[model samples]
Target chain A: MAITVRIPTPLRTLTGGADEVHAEGATVGAIIEQLEANHPGIKERICDDKGNVRRFVNVFLNDEDIRFLDGLQSPVKDGDTLSVVPAIAGG
Target chain B: MSGETPPWVKGALRIEAAVLRQVEADALACYPSEACGFLFGPADDPPLLDEMRREDNEADKYHRLDPETFPRTSKMYFKINELRAVRALEEGAASGRPLKVIYHSHCDAGAYFSQEDAATFASGGTLMWPCAFLVVSVIDGEVRDRKLHVHVPGTNGFRESPLTVIE
Candidate 1:
């Protein structure tokens, strides 16, 4: 499945300044892998060394948390939008 | 009005790298000591990590310490404010988000809330007796650790609990 993923500005360096990226995958993990394959270093920012999502970040699928869903294995159909928003700690 | 929890925070505690980065940057600007402040929630949403709003830090002249030795502490305290408690309640209602938590920083200490923090929470003059509190500790301009605490209304005062951010 091809889906559109939105990346925040802070991680834009890893994505070469691209605000949005497209990847093909069946699960969230696969989509992440595709993102990493296309843009090296992107995965490290989103995933930890053990391949788990970092606590400092949250992945929302259409405004709903992925954790309440299937987590990284959550399935994405075509045309779905995935928003990766890191919690903003700035005052 | 609290005993344990209402199950909402069972899986709602966590921060983001972007948030951490900003917090660290702000804390670094006042390095060599702690940078304390408050985090407000979104105008419409539930109390969660995503809803934090940083308020002004306490004032320096009020620091009760020698100003010459702790300049950062003085200037930093100058930035603190006694936030309008009603703003948090009204915003929570208008935005559907509640007073998620209060956040501060520690210069060289671990990211843990001190006894004074507990006393403040138990005071119950703010939004609620039970609320979330977060602390970020920086050393040499680097964030060494972070901690979150949840205060609950208790028999005499508010009870404190530790919050863990799970990956």
Candidate 2:
């Protein structure tokens, strides 16, 4: 399934400065893998060494965070927009 | 309760006196807990900030869910929900009033950007956002002072930006 992914500013370099890009996948994890294939050095920024989403990298499917769903195992369909945003937090 | 205003800091961040007051009010309301929000306005040499979009400090929820991941509580930190943030960014772009400033209050601390703050905005020496950061100092349920921080060039650090409050 082709999905549109919204890219944040910091990761724009990998996407040729495009704010959004399209990829093919049936799950969030597969989509991320597709993103890495399309844009090298992106998965490392979004996921940790354990292949888990980075705590500082916030990923959402539409208005809902994917973490709240099934995480990497989350199912996906057409017209789903995945947004990868930088976590806004500090002490 | 610190920070000196200088004509330095890229350019002044202009805000209506009333809107700024509302930000202080939110900071006061959160008091012991740090308050967080976004300042929406047109980007200009003197960015005119007119709206304040307050956010719920989601630190506590995250901290409770996984202390190993999110260790800081609301008392010491502020976390803006990313889903809401994506929506805000999208809406701001459509409305022509982009989020120019991400503001947060420091409970009983000075209005200086802490190390963690620097780490958040500039992880791996890469700046996350193109906007600025405003840190407010709230001590004893009262606002003492505030400061603006922008990414320092060629480094993973931020420098103070001038904040001009107008009436």
Candidate 3:
């Protein structure tokens, strides 16, 4: 399945300044693996050593948070858009 | 950097007096905890603030869900609820007024970008959005100070932006 992933500004460097990229995968985890193949060091930024999505990082499928869905295993079809959002906190 | 306006303060942000007052009031109302929200406006040379929308800090909600991992209370940090942000983005786009600023308040600290704040929003020299960040300092339930910071793009930091309040 072909999916489009919207890259946030913080991770644009990994994608060579491109704001979005296309990857092939049936699940979000597979798509992330595809992203890692295309852009080195991206998976580490999005996922931890245990392969779990970082607590501060959110993955969304078509504007719906993946955490509320099936997480990394969330299914993706052709033309689906995924967004990688970083959680920010300060006071 | 706290009170004295810097020489580079060339009026990068223009906001309405009523909106500014609302921000300060909201910050004070939240008190000991931080208040977070979005500023919607045009994507012009110097963005003009048209409206403001307050969002519930997700940190408080998540803390209620899993306190061990989300240890920090609302008093120390704020994570804008993702759902609210998405909805705001959609609605703003529909209205032709995109999000121009992300505003947050500090309980007792001065209106300045903390190290944690910079790292959280602009890690590895990349900012989440091409918008400015406004920090309001609320001390003892009073708005003590406010500052605007814009990402320096290539640099992993933000520079002070002059905020002009219009009546």
Candidate 4:
């Protein structure tokens, strides 16, 4: 299934300045892998050393956060939109 | 107080006096805990901010979940829920007024932008959002002076953009 991923600005350099891109995967993790294959260096920005979504990045699979729906293993289908939003935070 | 004094940015961040009042009130209401929100206005070179969208501070939640990763609680930090951020962005665009400023409260701290603040506003050495920042100092539940900071593109720094208030 082809999914649409909303690329945050920081990773735009990898996506050739495109704000959005299309990838194929059955799960969110698989989609990320596809993104890394296409864009390179993107997986590292979204995932940590343990492959868990970075604490500061929010991954939403069509309105619901992936963390609330089985995390990276969350199932997906065609026409789903995945948004990776960097946390607006400060200390 | 009318904004007819010094420190006007001429063509940057012209805001409504009522908006500042709302921001101050919101900061005061969220005192002892950091508050955060966005100001929306027409997509002009120097946007005239006239709308306020308050967001709940979720730093405490993150800190509680993983203190090692998020070391600061709501007392010293603030985090806008990602969902709300997305929604607000869309809402602003749909209404023809894009996000112009992001304001936050700093408890017991001054209005100077901290290193961590710069880090949060940027990603991988690039700024994510093209908006100004307003830091409101709230000490012991009392709001104090505030400062505005605008990104200095390619400099990795920010400069004060004196905010002008309108009637």
Note the DockQ of each predicted structure.
Answer: 0.01, 0.54, 0.46, 0.53
Candidate 3: misplaced stretches above 4 Å? A1-4, A12-26, A68-70, A74-81, B1-11, B66-69, B83-96
Task: List the TM values for chain B, per candidate.
Answer: 0.65, 0.90, 0.86, 0.87
**Per-residue C-alpha lDDT of model 3 across residues B1-167, encoded as one tens digit per residue:** 01122222223878998999888888988889999999887644335886888888777776786677578788988888664675576676566676678899999989999887787777665665545789999988889899998877666787788889998
Of candidates 3 and 1, the better by DockQ: 3
Q: What is candidate 3's CA lDDT for residue B61?
A: 74
lDDT of 1 by residue, B110-138 (tens): 67656545543433222132346677777
lDDT string, candidate 2, B107-162, tens digits: 99999999888888887666676568899999888899998898875689898878
Among these predicted structures, which one has the highest lDDT?
Answer: 2
Where in model 2 is the C-alpha error above 4 Å? Answer: B1-11, B43-46
Interface RMSD of each: 15.3, 7.7, 7.7, 8.0
lDDT of 4 at A65: 71
True contacts kept of 2: 0.77
The docking category that best describes candidate 4 is medium
| Tens-digit lDDT track of model 1 for A1-91 | 9999977555666778777889889988899999999989888877879887653455767656575588899999898877675531211
Candidate 3: docking tier: acceptable
Question: What is the Cα-based TM-score of model 1?
Answer: 0.47
Full candidate order by DockQ, most accurate first: 2, 4, 3, 1
True contacts kept of each: 0.00, 0.77, 0.57, 0.72
lDDT string for model 4 (B75-108, tens) is 8899888777767766766676776678898988
